[model samples]
Target: MNLNIKILNQKEINNMKISKKFTSIFLAGLLSASVAFSTPA
Candidate 1:
């Protein structure tokens, strides 16, 4: 039972890390895209 709880907590931590990475990447992409779109061609 303790092992299962530890596994669950580890999974949650891993998921949170993955989500933070993805969110940062997504926000950076959006910022670059906005800059490119705003610039005159």
Candidate 2:
């Protein structure tokens, strides 16, 4: 039971890392897109 809990915890941590990375990438894309639109062509 303890091992299972540890495994779940590790998975949760990994998922959190993935979520943060995805969020960062998404925000970066949005920032770039906004800059592109706001910039004068």
Candidate 3:
């Protein structure tokens, strides 16, 4: 049981890291898109 809990915790930690990376990438894309729209070609 303890081993299972540890495995689950590790999975959660990995998921958190992935989500944080995805959020940062999403934010960066949004910022760039807004800047692109605001600037004149």
Candidate 4:
């Protein structure tokens, strides 16, 4: 039971890391897109 809990915790940590990475990438893309739109062609 304890081992199972540890494994689940590890999975949660990995998921959080993945989500954070994706969020950062998404934010970066959004920032660039806004800047591109604001600038003259």
RMSD of each candidate relative to the true structure:
1.5, 1.3, 1.4, 1.3
- C-alpha lDDT values of all predictions: 0.99, 1.00, 1.00, 1.00
The lDDT, on a scale of 0 to 1, for candidate 4 is 1.00
Best by TM-score: 4
lDDT of 4 at 8: 100
Off by over 4 Å in 2: none
TM-score versus the correct structure, for each prediction = 0.72, 0.73, 0.72, 0.75
What TM-score does model 3 achieve against the real structure?
A: 0.72
lDDT tens digits by residue: candidate 3, 1-41: 99999999999999999999999999999999999999999
> Which digits, one per residue and each the tens of the lDDT, describe model 4 over residues 1-41?
99999999999999999999999999999999999999999
TM-score ranking of the models: 4, 2, 1, 3
Error at 38, model 4, angstroms: 1.9
lDDT of 4 at 36: 100
* lDDT, model 4, position 6: 100
Residue pair clashes in candidate 2: none
Ten residues in sequence with the least summed lDDT for candidate 4: 31-40
